[model samples]
Target: MRKDRKNTHLKCCIMEISGRITKDAVTAKVSNDREVVNFSIAINDSYRPKGAEELKKIVTYIDCSYWMGSKMAQWLKKGTVVELFGRIGLNVYNNAEGKALGSLTFHTSNIKILVFPKTENSSSLPAVQKKNTDQDTPDDLPF
Candidate 1:
């Protein structure tokens, strides 16, 4: 029998990023009769250069596409913080002006909402009790 040269130790690459949504998600139908949700996210970072006295903030924008159900688009609104896990993709194309353009894309396999931006009507909600300690609990136990 011939020897098999397949390498079983090869590793796959995975990327995870957390950022705020730049805008609401949009849904579109693909050629395969499937719906996809498209959105953008902005990741911000601050760092001080080698000899700089002050720190500078850098923002990286990434376009993301989700192939799951379109219902998720409704919850992904602007300013919502989300955590995404997926692979990175680079897309190159020509714009309407015939100029070459390139963009970084994140093909997200999984996404989670980290924080929902507070709305003006949120204040109308009732406040929750902080403590439920035994000292404050009623002695009427069914046990």
Candidate 2:
């Protein structure tokens, strides 16, 4: 039996996710033969209370998929930090062990390279060793 997901807000118009890419972008054509890109990302969230002992933080990993042109698929990579806004999607699949598995994927309408947030955290930006390396993906989510 599969656990029912109470939070079925996959249709949320926009969301801000800041985390490390878990896998390289997988590009494929949708059933309609339309180009689509898919990838997984993990977001880290912890808790810290004042005048308290050690606390554990909740970490969330959301699978992201970009159903767009081929240009977007060619621009995904592991460990790349990105901030995106799009709708959420879910899919069921069978693993090598033949067990039914489910995944939460994000269908982005637009994405951008995170530069700087109100808080100063340079680590969120992509670390490109080469000065002129291109890091923009073909993400076109709704603004």
Measured by TM-score, the strongest candidate is 1
lDDT of 1 by residue, 42-117 (tens): 9999999999999999999999999977878888888889999988887666666666667788888899989876
Q: How far is 118's C-alpha from truth in model 2 (Å)? A: 24
Which pairs of residues have clashing backbones in candidate 2?
109-140, 109-141, 110-140, 110-141
**Poorest stretch of ten by lDDT in candidate 2:** 115-124
Model 2, span 36-83: residue lDDT tens: 787777788878788879887887898877765667654466666778
lDDT of each: 0.81, 0.68
RMSD of each: 10.8, 11.3
Predicted structure 2: lDDT: 0.68
TM-score of 2: 0.59
